[model samples]
Target chain A: MDKSLQKTEQEEIESKRKVYREAKEQTRKNARRLRFDESNPQPKKDSVDSPRKRFYRQRAHSNPFSDHRLDYPKSPESMDWSKYYPQYHDKESNNMLQDVEIADIGCGYGGLLINLSKEFPKTLCLGMEIRVQVTQYVEDRIIALREQNKSKDINYQNIAVIRGNAMKFLPNFFKKSQLSKMFFCFPDPHFKQRKHKARIITNTLLSEYAYALKVGGIIYTITDVEDLHNWMVEHLTEHPLFERLDKQWEDQDKCVEIMYNSTEEGQKVERNKGDKFIACFRRLPDPEI
Target chain B: MKHPYQNIVSTSTHLFVSVQNHLQAFDVEGNLVGSWKDTIGHEDLLKKQQLEKIEKLNQEPEIKRAENNKKVKIPKIPTPGPGAPTIYNYIRDLELTHDNKYLIGITDSDKSIIIFEINLNEDNCLKLIKRQTFPKRPCSISIADDNSTVIIGDKFGDVYKIPIIGENVPEKDLKPILGHVSLLTDVLITEHNGKQYILSSDRDEHIKVSNYPITYVVKHWLFGHDEFISSMVQFDFDRELLVTGGGDDYIYLWNWYGNKLLSKYPLRDLIEPLLDESHLPPERFLHEDSPKEISVVKMITMDKFVVVLFQKVNGLLVLEIKDETLHLVELFPLDYPLIDISAGGDKIFGLSEDKIITQFTFNGKLTIDDKEFKGMIENNPCEVQSKEEFYPLYTMNTLRKRSEH
Candidate 1:
């Protein structure tokens, strides 16, 4: 073949390669959206022990967004899966053992969700917001994370924020001993006498906390409200299933980190140097009747 | 009954929505679970109100400092009652007449605007009396140019008028003034070039100046920026020139009477020096995406600096309209959505959508001579509308000279 012809063929090959590469990138982008977050997930197992081991098994796969391998809206009687599922699992990342499952009872702006998801990839954290605007925010953040390949490593899959009420739905998602920890940080401290009945704390509620936890599970709470802390202590103590975690143990508590790094409200509470109070309680063994 | 969070997975626990107050979460077996107290039904605002009571008492001659110091702080009780009404899911968008008594404020719940009669006793405190409710969630309200009638326009583009000082007149008493289809975002009672007109701006992008269906004059429709039309004002100092801003980024200025398009006032881009000392802060400011979803979120004016809310920027703002352009002044402390802001005489009152009414000077002062306000916030207890009354035990500032509607 002549030299000119050979050069023309070389140019054609280069252009074809460029087209192939663009097509491949397009395919990958499409796949990212279709593939739910399946990254680094541990199969449901009998080992309720070994938080670290559980972390690895859960983090064994890769996908930016994952739905715990369960279908969205696991049941249709309540929230529509279509609206709730699209943004469940966020950017897949390396799993880490420190990750623990968290439920942000009134997650206002996914600020808490983002913080917890990164802090404990081993933990599956959820932000529950009632306001559609804020709830949709968390849903988007999870998607952005997955699309960015933010969650690719570590020992566990970290987060799944839902738009629902922890007060109304706690029973729906969690069972006795399911959550190793519970965080009621910066809850409303209803102050009026008639409204006192509205405070999230009461002798009865403390019992609910006791019932939700495992024999050894712990409840961590914080507030800028000094009076509310007193209310929490009173209720937590009166309940039969709980005991105040010793102050010594309180300082060493790992859950404090999540509370400190929570969403907009938490940050606001922190900035005002508002009177902040922290409380911790453990689920004591149910005694003989 | 309202939860701003999701319902967790099913367990035996359930709290009936009807048992709204003082409800604790209980498993299906009737075992008490979580405290509904902490969630929707929590009374944090009440506690904050009581703290205000103590603060107010701290000002009294009777509650000696030593005596108050010695009294053990009751964690739950803030005060027995002399405080701002602790309202939940209510409406707010305030328009106070110059004297401050004839306040046209709206309650967001039932979407009603009320004209309240005001009286300030010896102390410069505030009192609201003779409340007449209208059938509209008012975005802007103004007393008729003659001061004979109160005109209020709702989000749904209905403007109703009631006699300012008169017998309780329901819907029949109302005269349909400015009727349109979409939201009528603003209404101004202005006299331009010697003729009086009701200048109304609506979602339809038209600002109509007229006496209504009888005969109408359409102002030049401000046709440029596109977004939900929010607030429109005839600059207090210069009622002829109009300044209007809304969901759109730009604030447009129009000749209030000539119907001439003047200029556009835009929020500082945070990068401009015009933002001055009031430059948007880096942290804690409400991010852009938060407030736009809900329209009619801010209420502003021109004479004083135009106060912008944080729903768009997550901060309290001041837009100083100069040469028809906006100069972003220093942002203030008020957060979330500012429901209503009114200025007249020597004071400015900012009422939050959450029922927080903050009064301050053009400069800044923590305390005001609210001593004049007798029966409104400082003295209100359990009140009866037609014939009911609630008398609580501990009373201090609760004793007002009292007035009857």
Candidate 2:
């Protein structure tokens, strides 16, 4: 029995190495294709379209303009989360409650999600992004990470990335009290007075966030702009369902450490020696009327 | 440059400036007269009380043991963000009544449309006459000819006609008069050939003219703009002529009565030189070599010229319409992108998003003393002197006109 177990372990290690090699080979081919495309540009119609144009076109066609069905799912249960995180698809256990419990809004390039996945391996996490190519790159990165770490039993099956406007489809993706943690890192500070309503954190949007978050859920926000940082702090501090967590608690939190250093934007800011302002708020229980 | 007001509406002598949470009226000479701030509504008071209660409960550890009920509706308390005071509660649309006795505005905070009676005799005292909440947030509002009725167009593409004289009506009592099935950008009530019609534009590049009061009957659908139509205006002299500016890099002229496209003014070259790449997002798609599109925010038309404000372009395009030809007048470059502009009695005011109000003459002359405007108290009353100098950052070349093939 001992000899048989040892043989099986050796086979598993060999298969894992093969998967890693195959993933590396696929990445190398993707790089080569990108180079070829650069040398001789493709004639695809979408190749000429910039990301801003694509973003505007997508917004004009979604939700209030066209059918909300395209951007929003009626219920979170209807969405197949397993397709995004295939390694987590357990065939032996027929459980329906297993789902993404953490979300990163506007997770550009998804550096935080990748880091947090390793810290909380059992918990499912999702990165929601609006840009198409950025989301695709993140998806590919996760696939590669999963293959490379298959042998170590610390694979990136807990994380996934999806391309969608988080502002419009947040409730569609998350059920009530479905999320334990939500993160907003390095959001675009609209700066313009008229465009403040387009901000991710508002009194109206906070209600939606509170509805999706568990009673004890935590909201983490970090930004480089002092004005935007103060704006987020004031809004979150005044929200009835949220209470600002103690600074000491945030300093000790492992997630906060990763949030400060893990994201692509965070690293860039670090290199520039830019000051990062972080604020965390815990969702209070519903008020007893 | 600072834009003290986000939206400015003008009569002949009175300029109703939308400041923070209230509407402040200024004379043609730029002296502060009356101010109007809407009182907290009943629902808003309840929301505030609930917030205070929650704060108390969260502070005391022993009282937190009480079981909380999830079914109770908790109202959202809008917190004033850290920036300019009252940043969250901005006037989405403000208009002066036909008689100039009342100033009406739509505030996005409580989704309330408030009417303030401006009594110039009593030191410009403004009394809140009525405040009504809408089912959806209103983007643009137009007071009717009689001033008793107002036509409001919402972001959801629904237009509703509510009586300004009536008692407060609940949300269920109010219904949309007409809808476009797409996000409505601007709405106008105009009389053409002795008949009233509702001229509306949307994000889907559609401009529809329908008979007012009986708006279900569509009269004309002008389809030329390929993107979001941000602003539209009817010529003061000839209502037949309509001008529209949008996400597309052109200003369109239309003869609405005949439903014909008269001329298209290409704005790409005029605005290309003013485009600052630093203002754009740092996303991968916004990298160098990508074509950028400039959008028009608002268009203000005077008798001889029309001033068009482009989004993110800190400059105003002064265009002259002579006979059937549209000629470029001059480009006055500003330090900041203005939010709203109002013109009356040979004076024009440009309101910036940074709370700087830059006043100009009808001939594109910067009127404010630069030192005082940048250093003094922003909200205090100050005399605005028009400098005889007309500084042109760039000379106006001939307009590059385009036509549909």
Ignoring the other chain, what TM-score does chain B have in each prediction? 0.54, 0.78
B1-405: candidate 2 lDDT, tens digit per residue: 222455788876777776556567776556667776655543574485578667765665553454553333444665557784322555667887777777888887777788888888888667788888876678888777778888888876678888877688887677566666556788988887778888888765667776776564455567677667878887778888888888777888888878778888888888888887643434543557655667787888888578898766778888877775567887777778776788766767777644456667675443443322332124533223442221211111101111111
Best by TM-score: 2
Best-performing candidate as measured by DockQ: 2
Q: What is the per-residue lDDT of model 1 for residues B1-405, given as tens digits with 9 covering 90 to 100? A: 112111111111222111112222223332333332213221444564577667766566655757666663544553447666643332234455644345455554334554544332313222334455444456667765566666677754556666667676664365455444445677777776566667666654445555322212222233443444666766568787776765555667777566566777555364132222222232353356433222224555635566554232334556676776666676564434343344433455443323323444554222232322221222222124431221121111111111121
lDDT (tens digit, per residue) of candidate 2 on A1-289: 6999999997887676566445544663553355224465433332222222111111211222232223334346557665666555654674444778899998888789989988999899999876545665676677566556656767887888887767645655786788999999998788886566567786545766877888899999998889999999998887778999998999899999999999988888899999999999999886532
RMSD of 2: 18.6
Query: What TM-score should be assigned to candidate 1?
Result: 0.36
Pairs with steric clashes in candidate 2: B2-B356, B3-B352, B3-B355, B3-B356, B4-B355, B4-B356
Query: Residue A84 of candidate 2: its Cα lDDT?
Result: 68
Worst 10 residues of 2 chain B by lDDT: B392-401
**Model number with the top lDDT:** 2
- State the lDDT of candidate 1 residue by residue for A1-289, as single tens digits: 9999999997787676555444433443443445454463542221211111111111111211111122223122233322223343233542222322456766666666666666665556766654443454454445445545534663223565665544423433544455667777777676665455345555523443444566787787788788889888877776666788777887776567667656566788778776668888887875532
